[model samples]
Target: MKLKRCFDLVAGLIGLCLLAPLMLLIACWVKFDSPGPALFVQQRVGRHGVPFAIFKFRTMAHDGTAGNVPRMWPAPCITRAGHWLRRTKLDELPQLANVVLGQMSLVGPRPELARYVACYPPAVREKVLSVAPGITDWGSIKYRDEGSLLAAAADPERTYIEDILPVKLAFYQRYVDQRSFWMDLRIIASTVSTLWR
Candidate 1:
């Protein structure tokens, strides 16, 4: 656990350093492309069910309705730049700050919104939240295109809550049960490969 935290701290700092210039460019692009701030911050359930502000590069229009999980298929609120940002997953880059702050890990179960956490089965919630939520995990890898999947569903929110959430929870549990430094590395490598491919 100590080693993992140290690794997360070091990796997060290094990532921020290496990615800062690109993040600035993306932030400028987001600002020029849309009317809102470059970063989006939302509360997510973290370790031990604590709520923390998770940051991401803003990928939606300036409308007040930008924060929640996608409720609409073909989400009409996405901005022109948002389309590409979300597609490339560049929208998640700001979360390195969260990782640096000790609020998140580089790899683990992805955090969920409070509403979604409330729906987690008690044992599952306990097991999953036993560790810090991560920037990427098996669930994230598998559902990388979750918004697109929901876009194709008849009732996107319902499908997310009923179908996708359960699968994600199972993945989260598995991650917690089998967690290790090596596992985290594998997950990170997989995420990079997945993104590149």
Candidate 2:
């Protein structure tokens, strides 16, 4: 997947350059609208069960998430600006750094919190973690409304583990089985379309 890495490096660098201004604006909005750093740093499981600190815009209030849970979490802790950032997916822009650093791919299984990854069955986990995790993937587009769906559940954590996660895992398996440059391109295109809608 050296070619994929090359694409990720170039695209990530270019993306950061192009989105710098908008990222700056969002950073300001987060600062003014809340009392924390604009960047949210969290440990997620990368390829082969390795942990890495991935970055996203702060879409929750300071001290909102003392711990990560494996569930949809558009909680009351979301600030006004944070809500918008999450809605528009602008919060994920900083992940270009992760892409450039080779911690992630542009199109592959979305990285999961270690807490969530811990829940994966042994064989399933091995297979899923065999490749680099991604910022967007087939599972991501299908589960684009995950936060909202989780918000509506009677038990968000339970629902995610029992329902949402399995579905996402199935898609992950398909993506792994069928992956290629063209498939990656399609996944990226689908991701953009999902965001636009």
The CA root-mean-square deviation of candidate 1, after full C-alpha superposition on the true structure, stands at 1.4
Q: Write the per-residue lDDT of candidate 2 for residues 1-197, one digit (tens) a residue.
A: 88899999999999999999999999999999989888888889999989999898887777756346332474887789977887888888999999999999898888998777888989889999999999899888877778898889998988988998899999888888899989999888988988987
Off by over 4 Å in 1: 69-74
Clashes of 1: 0
Q: How displaced is residue 42 in candidate 1, in Å?
A: 0.7
At residue 85, give the lDDT of candidate 1: 84
Candidate 1 is scored at a TM of: 0.96
| Candidate 2: segments with Cα more than 4 A from true spot | 64-71
Q: What is the C-alpha local distance difference test score of each model?
A: 0.88, 0.86
Worst 10 residues of 2 by lDDT: 65-74
